[model samples]
Target: MSTIQRPSRPCKECQRRKLRCDAQQPKCGLCQRARVPCEASPAGKRGPKRGHLDALRNRLVQLEETLQNRLDSEQHPQEHAQALHYSPGSTDASQSTDFLRGDVGYGDPLPQAFMLPGPSMAGDADTLGLGPFPFPDLAVSLPQIDRGTHAELDQLYFDRVHPSFPILHKRRYLNWSKSTAKSRSQTCLQQVMWILATLLSTQSRDLINPLYSRVKQDIDLIIMDTGPCQLELVQAWTLLTVCELMRALYGQAWASAGRMFRLLQGLRYHEIDSPRKDPVASEGMIDPIRTEEKRRVFWMAFLIDHLLSIRNRWPICTRLPISDHAFQAAQLGSSTFLSQAVTEPPSSDTCSFNECIIIATLSGRGLLRDVHGTISEAYGGSGQIHIDHDEWLNLVLATRNQALRQRNDSDRMGTFAQILGQVTEILFCKSLMTMNKNSSTESCTQEYRCRVLRAAEKIVLFAADLTALHFSMVHPFMFIPLFVTAEFLYENRALGDGAFLTQLRSLVDVFGQLTNVNDHERSYLDLLSRSCQQNIAIMPATTCVELKRIARDFLEALEDPNDPTKAQAVASADLSVTHESYPSTEGLEQFLSGWAKAKQFMPNFRMELVDMVAEVDASGSGGKVWVFSKVTGGGGGTDRDSIDMMSINGEGKVWKTKDVQRITSKH
Candidate 1:
């Protein structure tokens, strides 16, 4: 075939560089000269399709028509007053404009996207910024620390603390007052001091010993001076009461710490006089002590609730090693009113620590269960509705029976869902505390953890907003659902930690409930419906894929019968080949499956696969590696703790590559 000689097309600069050109402006000439991948458009190419252009034009015309109609109505004195009643639909505002210009899209809007909810509502005192607030510099006015003071105290404390369940520390910036202003420095120091103190309080709660009592007493004395202490006192009191019940159940000393915790809980939400007549004020609101307080509470609640699950013999973890049977028996046999304790009339001698324990325990357990469900569903599924049809039917039956029983006993008391919701705040607060400070670069090994946290914070806010809505609507019926969602969100926060996308979806789902309520305010209902629909529609496709992968992992884990190491190894390799370290719960499960698969062929097989790693070295160069291996697996057999793989590894041992393991013999 004879080739027709066509004129070569090259932009001026590309011709100078003697380079083949895609022949485009802006990016063509310089990029071609640099031998870079030229992103310049090919000559004579048109931009995005004309359909988009036509759509834009139609939208503009429609908006213009509406505006013109509004202006025309305004300009005529005869119709000016009537214009107020003229709805857009009556004026020729096309439905397409409403549909096309629905609301803000999925991706973050530049600048405004980053602007935060606080700045958007800057005029309001109640609002706080979504991101970490910048700590103002005030150190110049502060007194210098003495040489004796261990300046590394803060860092040391963080190190000694149990690696917070999630690896990353919530981001918090340093705010020190200047030498000239010792007062501000003192204030900031006090805040940090309280935060650290509260964290230590939860740690102490777990100690469950005589030393714990003395330590808590002394700690209480110190924290009582801080602003958030009053609430902390309630938590402390609750912990102490629970401890006392434990002791009392075993015939130990009748410690009166229960009264202190009760007094504190009762003190919360009590209204205070304010010079500003802000109608929104409820009680002297519990200003978060340190950002971590709520998180600590959630974690504590999570632990306690799991304990309750074992106690109640909840079927979910029945296969796991826990004293579920013994717990259930004890619960049934106990006559000291453990279940009904909190509601019982308090005696003069003691407020019945048993009641506080039961109530707190119930609250904690509810939060944990809900959170587990949320995280499990979020991190390990295909966006499928988690409702087990059978489970829902059972729940309906149980709730109906309980509702009837409560009606027969005391009409004033809440329904089962309401009680669940009320107790959930305890867990939710903890989740908030843990997540409120997410500014660190710590590798998230659990994908769902971050997702859960993000969803939780948003959900909590959504619930709070909905609660306000219910109160505004003057509908008592809405409270139970609100509480249920709040509790669910609270647990979600604790479990997900800071998984932003997952958490946002969770919140959207709960907000969806408000939209369904007929009594909800029309404006709020509209905003919620639109926001939720938009969020769901625009959620990134990658997230859906990740969610599905996570779900698949969970399903595989649950279904696989063989606990063999070989089988697990095969599964792990299949799941985690793409990432070195497990980026999420799903990834971890995949690794566990790999280990199980490996054991099938090599009974003694044990392996660890760490992915998405960043190790800081002395010279600051960072390197990462991934491995699939076969090795010995040995440990104290129990599900309560993770295997100490580091301790188990022999010094100088290296894993060599081998044939990929498969979960089944057929493979």
Candidate 2:
């Protein structure tokens, strides 16, 4: 520990710490006292190299020249592009904005999962330390939205995709994303929940396509993974099926649904319906909530299977895992079996996922099942099968009752439950009538005919209930069945009562006011509407109301034959005469042609007549009419006009354009 004369150069340790080194022979005094080895460098060993100043000057000179060149180019687009070097692995401008932002520094490679459906980092996989990046790949940058944004999506989902539909579990899924687990299946689930939320969100437009595409890629990887089945993956694919169905991608939805169902079977989700644990199965130790999730997912898939079958008019791919009418109260017997099928027991009276599944199952099996059957019974299956009329009626009634029961409960399910039931009965009668094309009224099922006519009126009232609400956000189940109801009403207009054509006309107008958020059944909507209008043009329509009900400064005519009929009598001060809203024969043909183009773009739109006078004599001659207003849905404000209409017994015959003339009218 002697303090000798200081060495010219300090020991490496002293130099590193900028401390004085004692420079003793064995070791620096400081190093020796610290019991550490130290090596002192020779003088000037680490000094600047000879001519370093000159090299520094030269480097500065080079930088000055480069700056001068850049300035001389003035950052021309092409010149700037050549000057700024991009990372070799950088891709098109479409890289995610909310994720993976900024330059990808060297060695900071994209995770194998994110790079999927795209190339990876610049070098060979081994060189970059990723090594083929492994299938059932780990670490994709699954959604990393801020808590606020994530929360908003959760709200969006619960708000729009009602829990009663049962595609996903809210609390479980949101918690899973926040979990520390980064397994491949976890990534798939996280990505799909993100996509579902994005698809449901109104403000997240840009995120949908990217999220959708990436989730699909993640799903493909999960399906190919050799590891054990993951419940989360099944759940992800269930939500994915919904996404596809929402976009009307039926083929993709079907294929995805099949894969998901197979995965569900692989995981033995079908057997999990019972609460008892199986001794030999790994699932014996599964979290109780997870078991509940499996059931929810199974029911969700069951519903999807029935939906696909109904939409396609084909047999259900999932088959009848349980009885089609397994919903019978006496059979199920106070079990609340469907109640346990969800994570939470349904919130009291609101229809649960089980309710939805039962209705879909019954509709698919009864009315639409072998839908081509007629007279003796041939609703479908190309008439190869036969059932007794009493048996057939029983089936229809069971489905009808179940559906009506859904409607009777709180509509917390969003779409009206009554819609499904009424439409089923309506379509049931429609099928019988359609199949019995050659049969007389006596040969057809009278009860079914009556049901069809009643439903035609009932479905309109059901839809009318949707006014003033955000119709676009409602489920497709609402519009799809409503569309079916409209078509049925149109075809059976002849069998309708006094108000039948008016009701038929009212239902037909729904085809226009109702804006299907998703482009579902797009192919047939327009054509069905045109045919209904053409028929209404030829069929007789009589609307009777007291004149006191007609409001001032409004014209209610046959214009906008597509707008949901607002045949409601307007409540006004004057009680002069009765009112009727009818179209001018002179304008009906022209109105038909321009319906789509002239129609207002309103999502929750409906139209109601405000003021009018029906002055036609019992002789049914054309007459002059006066002013009225029509209250509209969705697109705000009223359509006020003055019109004089003319008509006759135009039923069952095409009206020539010259048959009626436009009388004097003022707006």
State TM-scores per candidate: 0.19, 0.51
lDDT of 2 by residue, 41-113 (tens): 5554467545656666775676676556545555444544332323436644443431245333211323322
- Per-residue lDDT over 246-362 for candidate 1, one digit per residue giving the tens place of the 0 to 100 score: 222312212333233223222211112213324254221333222223333333333333333323232121011111122222221212323233334433222111222333444
Worst 10 residues of 2 by lDDT: 545-554
Error of 1 at 109 (Å): 46
User: For model 2, what is the alpha-carbon lDDT of residue 587?
Assistant: 32
Point to the candidate with the largest lDDT: 2
